[model samples]
Target: MNAEMQVILDQLEEENLGIRKKAIEALKKWEYQLELEDACLLLEKAAEIKPLCEDEWDNPSYALVTAACIFIHEDMVPVIEKNILRYSLRAAIKVLSFLLVLNTESAISLYKKTFHQFYDHGFACTGV
Candidate 1:
């Protein structure tokens, strides 16, 4: 992994949830500058850390999803798709919903990919 990805993964493993949450939030701000592979890797790591609270404020998934939105390329969509069902469905919906807000060509492709995944999983796009 690259230095940034290492930092992200390390943060995910931090004992302090505050530190991990801040790191994830910072990653979101830096997402556009990261390589697509690195961003996807970081998201994977973020997803592995279970949420400590149901509220978005305490959940790292919010940050992870926001970060993922920045690099929603066709190639990375599969990575997100593969892990969608592994994490909290509510969290996945929150992240994927943010992805839909991105209007870039890559974002549109990811939106379709994610939409299909949610639909296949029996989630209603309209409600989530």
Candidate 2:
């Protein structure tokens, strides 16, 4: 991961909406400029964040998830896990559905463990 990317990610927690926005944009730019593995690490870190607000537009976690979608997908799984409570239930579901499209196995497993009562019966984790 780029050291500069981590620096910008730190700004996401800034209370100033404008500062977070600029930081989000800068991180998004790195999606194009950085190598895929480094970018993935950057985005994964972003996903680990929990936004403080419900405003999707100003929520850096949401912005990071959306922006990182273009270059990173698998890393989003943990993001959904960690930040599920930070967002409203609706927004949380939306992000999960998006992850399902990107990586179905991880998303479904996460969904089952968290929400599906039958999940404990015998739904297995498969490579497919």
Compose the digit string of candidate 2's lDDT tens values, residues 1-128: 56776677778877777787788677546445556565455445544555555555554554554545564366557765665544433344455667667667887787656555225533221100
By summed lDDT, the worst window of 10 consecutive residues in model 1 runs over 119-128
Q: Show model 1 residue runs off by greater than 4 Å.
A: 1-5, 53-55, 89-91, 98-128
CA displacement after TM-score superposition, residue 102 of candidate 1 (Å): 7.3
Q: Whole-model lDDT for model 2 versus the true structure? A: 0.56
TM-score quality measure for candidate 1: 0.63
Candidate 2: RMSD to truth? 7.5
lDDT of 1 by residue, 18-54 (tens): 8777776776576354678776875575467676554
Where does candidate 2 stray beyond 4 Å? 27-56, 71-79, 87-91, 112-128
